[model samples]
Target: MLANPALNKLRQQIGCIEETQRRFSRTIPVTEPVDRWLPYGGLSTGCIHEVKGTNLASAIAFSAILASRLAGDQGNILYIAPDRSLYPLGLLSYGINLDQFLHVSTRKSQDLVWTAMEALRCPQVSSVIALLSGLDLTESRRLQLAAEASGVTGFFLGHAASAPIASPITRWKVSSVAGKPGQRFDKPLWTLDLLYCRGGRPGKWTLEWHSQALLPIVPQLPAKQAAREALAG
Candidate 1:
């Protein structure tokens, strides 16, 4: 006797549901606080995120925050810098240890994208950051597939004037905010806009460089710290 086609479809659906549940169960929590702003409360392992900005400083700052977060305790970050050099000192100023990060520079944009995909497939790499002059749909799809296979987060950096291609789970646009001129130290201020996201709304928010702790500036400190400072005062 032949099996019923309806039963086969039902079984397939059940199997798919079970596989999705298992995958979600195995997902590791993102180790960085900044990730909370992203959909799913953090960067998903198998997706591509795009960063574009008129302000180079803002773009770099955003990328550094994501990279540092992904590095966590023992993992390493791979940065494919195509146009500008990866400033170790600048990363350190943002409280990121360049020692835990590897910078791979390529002269051409095409090479950078290919290198980024290859690096993402490396099991030892926790995350991959690719600074690209531009990315088309085909390239984005290729990177996305690689990221999914390797369970690595791929960050694509594009110029503000570059044409937008749709492959990113999330797209962000950053801009520089005016800063106080007379301050003792000059720190860059940035505004991050969530241009598009797979499962979230688009909005704009402000962030700054931490002048004291050398970390990405957040709006508020932990509640415990706030309480402690209040009691002290």
Candidate 2:
């Protein structure tokens, strides 16, 4: 059997191009605790990630926070929702640049998926946040491929109760946490459960949003009468 030299040369060229793309692609830095669990040490740009929560509101907030980071100073974010209920100004509280965000409202489920895939294919779009009830694994894989080709970050925000699909490199579950009695809590707190992560270990932690960062919450010990209570015996 004889091999074609021209075909081998073409394959070698394609391999070089793919290697170059991997070298130049960027990653969006999440918090230390979260990034530590990711194989890339951060959220890789050319991929899809999912955020699920006990309540959709918390999930939206968490995704918005990630979008804010992904947008950086000059990147543009495309936000696609089922309806026009999203208030763009509300994202300001998360340190997002409202001017850099473009919200698209589509009620149709297929349209939502189509719009997200299109937006992800655009190189100018730094990130895309799609609020959906659910999507099949094939649709998710299409979104992932589009993002990978354009070097864009994509997020699927949905309810944690929904049946899990495929294609996301990481899936996070956020559950709101209440403050202690008579305590003054200025930041939003959540119990984050890493539902699954490809090529990384899953973990759970209690974290709070403070000063534009997600920080792990550490329990405090009382001064005098906490010895027996701390021992839990």
Candidate 3:
């Protein structure tokens, strides 16, 4: 006798939930304040995360920080940025080891997307970060499935030039914020808004990516301290 279709579908959903729970039981470390809104007190390792590039500076900084933390020093990270203008030397201040990065510098968005999808399917990589312009629902679903299958996390970095694409488990919007005074360059401050989360309430937080006097940015203390240091000098 054939089983009921509706019951079979429900069973499939339940199984997916259980399996996903088991796979994502471990969480990637995030900033303390930001972690509060995340499920399981951290970002899931084997999931797809979205970071929009409305403010290119903040968006890319946010992605780099997490990718560095998650990749640690062992696992490979595939970064597909077709038109990335970032200086590789400066990324070292953010704790990103150049050796662990596999940078895909392409001239076309189509090739970038293809490379990202393929990277996501590879289990050896810990994470795949792609700066893609256009993506349809079907393509997003394929990427999502690939991420799930490999149990490797993915980050889709998009910009306002194209509407948001992909139904990721979590989405974030990062924008630049003013740094304290006496700072020759801003300290990479950003207001992070958690646009959506699968099992958590959305909220916002501010983050300052600590850095030394790296190129494209210079060192400075918090405003008050900087003022005092200046006065003493």
C-alpha root-mean-square deviation, each candidate: 7.9, 6.3, 9.1
Cα lDDT tens digits for candidate 3, 1-233: 57999999999999987975666666876776666668778888777888975677556667777888788779888888876686777667677789998888898867877898889999999888888777888888889889888888888887635577768888888877687676534357666778888878897776666553122233447999999989999
Per-model CA lDDT versus the true structure: 0.70, 0.82, 0.77
Index of the highest-lDDT prediction: 2
The clash tally of candidate 1 reads 0
- Candidate 1 residue lDDT tens string, 1-233: 56999989999999997775343222333233435665566556656778888966567667767667666777788878865565667677654677788878879877887798788777788778777756677877888877777777777777788876567877888887776576433356677778887666786666665542223445667899999999999
Q: Between candidates 2 and 3, which one is better according to lDDT?
A: 2
Best candidate (score: TM-score)? 2
Query: Comparing candidate 1 with candidate 2, which one achieves the higher TM-score?
Result: 2
Model 2: weakest 10-residue lDDT segment is 20-29
Task: Candidate 3: list runs displaced more than 4 Å.
Answer: 1-17, 184-186, 211-233
Shift of residue 141 alpha carbon in model 3, Å = 1.1
In model 2, residue pairs whose N, Cα or C atoms come closer than 3 Å (at least 3 residues apart or on different chains), thus clashing, are none
lDDT of 2 by residue, 1-233 (tens): 35999999999999997885464236676778777777777777778888888988778788888888877899899889988877776677777898898989988999998899899999999889888667887888888888888888888888888876587888999999996675445467899888888767998888888888888887566755578776775
Instruction: Give the C-alpha miss distance for residue 207 in model 2, angstroms.
Output: 1.1
